[model samples]
Target: MKPGKVKFPATKKGYDAATIKDVLPEGAAPFRRRLNQEVDITCIEEGFYGIICTPHDDMGMVMVVRSGDDHFPG
Candidate 1:
């Protein structure tokens, strides 16, 4: 993933809200990495089905992918 691929929220509260409520498959550990002053998240799952997100509505990024054909916009 590129730096532009994942852009986290400006505040901790927004970042928390973006990830805390997400429910990934079993054995999938929470992923968090600090990039400079911002902490971005790569919450998308591998395989045919997964999710993609955009930064808006205080949700940071919110996207869903559920097929091999599914596309993630840049």
Candidate 2:
């Protein structure tokens, strides 16, 4: 793979990112990933931040978004 090209697996059921983003209601924030197949997003704090699981095994995943309001997912 190159620096930005994505190679989707043969088992994926969806491909349209815009359609997925549209599924969320207005004012809702979304975190999109192109290469991630099996992701686990979790709220690090009660309602402050969330983590996006990385493909790397040794490297730790970090918070990709932080929110104090209802815009972000719980």
- The model with the greatest lDDT is 1
Q: Give the least accurate 10-residue stretch of model 1, judged by summed lDDT.
A: 46-55
lDDT of 2 by residue, 25-70 (tens): 3454455545524343333232333333334323544433433344
Judged by TM-score, which candidate is best? 1
lDDT (Cα, 0-100) at 41 in candidate 2 = 38
For candidate 1, the per-residue lDDT at 15 reads 31
Q: Write the per-residue lDDT of candidate 1 for residues 1-74, one digit (tens) a residue.
A: 22123455555432322333354433334543332245544434432222323234355454432322334445
Flag clash pairs in model 2.
none
Alpha-carbon lDDT, every model:
0.38, 0.35
Q: Estimate each model's TM-score.
A: 0.29, 0.26
Candidate 1's TM-score: 0.29
Error of 1 at 72 (Å): 15
